[model samples]
Target: MGAFDMLSIAGSSMGMHQTWLDSLANNIANVNTVVSTSQTAFQTQTPIVRALAGGGVEVAGLALSDPNGRLVSDPGNPMADADGYVRAPEDDLATQMTSLVMAQRGFQASVQVTKDAQDTYRSALEIGRR
Candidate 1:
């Protein structure tokens, strides 16, 4: 692949991972958000990454978790219903944390790849100066 192609691939990977990280952050942030039993709780979103026909990856779309969140008993909470129940997100903190780490690593790796590609390109230019 050409220097530009390598950089573009790395850039695409970084973008996809960044989007994934963003969604994971949102999910973690709203993990404890509660709503009235009659309302839908915050739904977690997952980024769907797809490979391009020529090269690189992209975030094709977002897949959302179930809207019908689990019911929790928080009698004292104002958002609780008459039956002392409220809707809480079904997101699992452990899963979200693990995904966060994976996405971070992926982003870092892509950055490294981009840097390496640039360094190689620079080295080629220096050699041509001889």
Candidate 2:
């Protein structure tokens, strides 16, 4: 691939990683949400990440978690259902933390790639002028 293509790919990778981070943030924010039934549970969301063989990257879609929300029985809870059962999201905090770390790494790598490309171009210009 050309240098421009490398830059574009790296740029797109950074964007994708940003989207992933956003998704993870949203999931973490709603970790305590309560739903009445399986159909209405607050599902953890994950980004559909795909790699481009040639250049760049694209987000295909977002996937919803389905491991089943925890059925907590609390009659006094505001979101409690008629049977006193609340569907709390089944989010694993440790898993989410790991994902956040991975996303951060991906973003950092993309940024470094773009920066290197810029430095290479600048060096070439200096050589041409000399």
Candidate 3:
């Protein structure tokens, strides 16, 4: 592929990673969300990424986790059920943190690729000038 194509691929990857990071952040933010047992709990969102045939990445959609939240007993809470149990989001903080780190690394790598491509293009132009 050409330099422009490489840049496009890297740019797409960066955008995809950004989306992933945003979703992870949302999941983390709602990790402690609680709801009545009769209602659905906050579901963790995951970005669906797909490889394009033209050498770029695309965000297909988001996948939501099952509504199987953890049941916690808290009799004092106002939102607790008849059994003094509330449903908490099943989001795992550790897993979300790890995913965030991975997404950050991927974004950084894509930025580096974009920078390298720009540098290569600049060098080629300088050679032509000479």
Candidate 4:
């Protein structure tokens, strides 16, 4: 509606994208995690974003991906099961990388919006002072 409102919206978007990027990074970091058969494998985390009433976004919660991971046969590994199989996180590196790129772009767009809004406000103030 207003310049300030636009800035608020951009700020909220930036925050939401930051959360998304953080979750993506976490998922990527644990992509190669190996766990014992008895232990649960690292589950990918996704940020749950929701639109606010006025005009903004918020991270409502975190959604965990399926806990079922891939089984890797490693006879020499200590954490392997009786069948010499270890559970590895089912994280897809390609998907995580793609999501990371999207989030980065979203964050950059929001930053640009905020910067533009600020510049417009500054120019208005300068014009008013003239």
Candidate 5:
């Protein structure tokens, strides 16, 4: 592969990581979302990534957590059912936070790779000029 191919690979990785981060953010944002029994609870969004045969990665699709959420007794909630039951997603905050951290690291690493590749290409140009 050419030296510039590293930049393309890093860019694709960064894009995939960004999508993952977005999904994680959405999941975290809806962590406390509660719905009436008549409605389905919010589902956690997960990005499905796949590797390219040539190089880099891509977001294939999004997978959602189970729709069957746990019931909570919240009689005070306006959306609560007649029995004071509300549906909340079964997503775990710990798991979401962990994924967020990992995705951030992956994005940062990809950015670093892009910078390194640019620096290497620039140094090579300087050597050729010398």
Candidate 6:
């Protein structure tokens, strides 16, 4: 592939990584939300990414959180049902944080690839000056 194609691949990777980071952030933010029932509880989200054969980016889909919500027993909580059980997303903050870190690392890697490719192309131009 040409230098331009390498650039396209890196750009697409960066875009997809951005979406991945956003989804992780949103999931972590909603970890504490309470719902009246498990069925209606907020669900975490994840981004599905696929690479194009030639070049560019394509989002496969958005994966939703698990259907079963975590139950917490707190009689004083207003949202609690008759059994003092409240429904919240089962998503773990720690897991989401870890995912965020991974996404950040991937983003950094893509950026480095792009920068390196750019430098290589720039250096190639020096052939004319020689």
TM-score to true structure, per model: 0.92, 0.85, 0.94, 0.91, 0.91, 0.91
| Candidate structures ordered by TM-score, highest first | 3, 1, 5, 6, 4, 2
For candidate 6, write residues 1-130 as lDDT tens digits: 7659989998999999999998888898898888665347778888888779898676788988776678878778888888988888878888889999999999999999999988988898897679
lDDT of 4 by residue, 1-130 (tens): 8659999999999999999999999999988888888888899999998999989999999999778787889889999988999988776799899999999999999999999999999999999999
Off by over 4 Å in 2: 73-75, 81-84
Stretches > 4 Å off in candidate 6: 55-57
Give candidate 2's root-mean-square deviation (CA, Å): 2.2
- Superposed Cα deviation of residue 8, candidate 2 (Å): 0.7
Write candidate 2's Cα lDDT for 2-117 as tens digits.
Answer: 75886899989999999999999988788777766544678888889788888788898999887577788978886677888888777767788899999999999999999999
Q: Candidate 4 deviates by what RMSD?
A: 1.4
Tens-digit lDDT track of model 3 for 1-130: 8659989999899999999999999999998899989989899999999999999899999999889788889888899988899988886889899999999999999999999999999999999999
Superposed Cα deviation of residue 65, candidate 3 (Å): 0.6
Candidate 6: residue 78 Cα off by (Å): 0.4
Go through the candidates in order and give the clash count of each. Answer: 0, 0, 0, 0, 0, 0
Clashing pairs for predicted structure model 1, backbone only:
none
Candidate 6's TM-score reads: 0.91
Candidate closer to the true structure by TM-score (higher is better), 1 or 4? 1
Q: How close is each model in CA RMSD to the real structure?
A: 1.3, 2.2, 1.2, 1.4, 1.4, 1.6
Between candidates 2 and 5, the lDDT winner:
5
* Model 1 stretches with alpha carbons more than 4 Å out: none
In the range 4-25, model 1's lDDT, one tens digit per residue, is: 9989999999999989999999
Compare the candidates by TM-score and give the number of the best one. 3
Q: Ten-residue segment with the worst summed lDDT in candidate 4? A: 63-72
**Candidate 2 clash pair list:** none
Worst 10 residues of 3 by lDDT: 87-96
The window of 10 residues in a row where model 5 has the poorest summed lDDT is 63-72
